[model samples]
Target: MKILVCIKQVPDMESRFRPNGEKTWYDESDLAFRMNEYDEYAVEQAVQLKEQLGGEPEITVLSIGPERTVEAIKKALAMGGDRAVHIRDDRYYQKDPWQIASMIASYAKGEGFDLIFTGMQSQDRGSAQVGVIVAELLGVSCATTLVGFSYDGGTITVKRELEGGIKGVAKLKLPALVTCQLGLNTPRYPTLPNIMKAKKKEIASLTAAELTGEAELTATAAIYPPAKKGGGLVLEGEIGAQVDRLMGILKEKTAVLR
Candidate 1:
């Protein structure tokens, strides 16, 4: 079996982020980057499937970003990905979901992969659109928010969570794509030996020009953080009066408060 896992390198959420002077993107100076938290789950699922398949399933991790993105790919290799492919373009951030998905689909078109996996959403933009778009572009079956997965011969069964704790199960034919959410499986960490071995693994590099020619679907007009939240109200009165005021506030917030 062959599996293709799409991973992304994102700015660490813990970093102090401030828009650059142009108000386009964060000032990346001295910022540390890592594989996106959500995508890590996808990588873990791919590696786990490969290990379970027992017949040396081919797993290739793919990503799009600048040259530094190779570090994130290396992390996936240490976790057991067979190899990696990097789509190098310093302006990846400027591209929209359609453009990004088009680039991935372009490379994936000729590659005969049985399955493709990606994070449900990216941490930075939280667009949650690339995986589905890729699936559509590739003209394959697609599933999202996958929590349960199993493979049998040429078909795979997957379960996804719906609202109100409902689970949806479906059987997808081969050459399908899925966007994995958390809680599917506990992601394993890389060991010292695996980290050393990852250095020797293959990481094929490519450029955006070599992939596809698609214009960005959306443009960022400006960027700003949310405004500061309002301070809480203090009820200064006797117990009975405070209770009455609290009831009024709750009533305004919710109809059941009455």
Candidate 2:
């Protein structure tokens, strides 16, 4: 079996962040980067599946980020990924999920992987669209937010987490994609020897220009913090006047019965 896991490097959640002068993004100068939280689960799931299969189930990890992001790739390799590919971009800071997915799919389409795994969503953007988009680009079946997975007779069965505490079960043919959700499995720490071995392993590097041919589908317009929520309304009038004002407010909100 051949598996590919996609991951991202993101700012540490505990760090304090400040918007840039344009209020469009953060000042990353003092930020620390780490492997995206959910993708860690995906990596663990892939490695565990590989171990269970035991007959050289090739596991490769792919990541898109600046040079500093290679650290996360190394961590995945140390966690038992057979190899890794890094799409390094120091100047590209835009967050376009479709473009990223396209780049990955372009590179991976020729790899003939049997399964592809990615986090349900990236920590920074939380778009939750990249994995499914990649599947579409590759023309493969897809399942998202999978908390349980297994393979038998060339069929991949998975349990997905859905709204209202419901678990959705799906069976997909080989050569599919799935976005991993949290609580699926605990990620294993890279032992010292494995970490050392990972340092010697090779990581292939590629640029977006090499992997993609088409331009991105969308572009950013502007970004600003959401408006502060308003406090509840206070009525300071006679009972009838207050009642009338309340009714008017409700009507404005379209909350009143017609």
Candidate 3:
């Protein structure tokens, strides 16, 4: 089976984020980066599936980002991916979900992949929409937050985690998309030997325009995050007096009443 897993490089969760000069996104100067945590589960799942199937599955990790993303992809390789494709686009920093999905779908459309795996969401954006969008674009079956999976003869069965003590299971044909959830498996650490081998693995790079054959972004702008504010407190008073005082404050501040 040929498995394709989508991965992402995001700011290290430990960093303290602050807004750039603009008020739309965070400044990244002091931040470090790591692979998206959930995508790591997806990678581990693909590797385990290949082992159980008794065939050398060609597992390819795909990412859309800047040069730093190579480090993240290498981490996957160190764990157990056959190769990687890095869509090295500077504009990837500001891409919305639609554009990101479009690029991945465009590249994966005819790759003869038996299964496509992705994380539930990216750590940086947390927009849990890419896998569904990519599945829609490819016109394939999709299962999200899959915790367990097994294959029989030619059909693949998946177990998904859901809310309120509900879990879902389904079977699908060769070509399918699945987004993995946490607790699917404990990801193994990369041994020193595997890390050395991973460094030698080839990481192929492609441009966004090259992949899409046309420039898709309208224009790239400097992104920044919103400002922080101090917390407010409610003062103690009698219930009736508090009600009257709150109404007066609202009226004075908002001009709700003259």
Root-mean-square deviation of each candidate, in angstroms?
5.3, 7.9, 8.0
- Residues 153-248, candidate 1, lDDT per residue (tens digit)? 878899998999899999999889999988988888999999999999999999999987888779888888778687689789699999999999
Better-scoring candidate (TM-score), 1 or 2: 1
Q: Model 3 lDDT vs. the true structure?
A: 0.85
What are the lDDT scores of the predictions, listed in order?
A: 0.91, 0.89, 0.85
Compose the digit string of candidate 3's lDDT tens values, residues 1-258.
899999999998878887666544677788998989999999998898888878578899999988888989999999899899999987675677778899999999888788899999998888799999999999988888888877776678889999985889899887889898888788888899999999988888888886664344443465444554765657587999888888888888886676
Q: Model 2 misses residue 44 by how many Å?
A: 0.4
- Could you say which candidate leads in TM-score? 1
For model 3, the stretches where C-alpha displacement exceeds 4 angstroms are 213-258
Could you tell me which 10 consecutive residues in candidate 3 have the lowest summed lDDT? 213-222
- The top-ranked prediction according to lDDT is 1
**Ranking according to lDDT, highest score first:** 1, 2, 3
How well does candidate 3 score on lDDT at residue 231?
57
How does candidate 2 fare on TM-score?
A: 0.85
Q: Model 1 residue 126 lDDT?
A: 89
TM-scores of the candidates are: 0.87, 0.85, 0.82
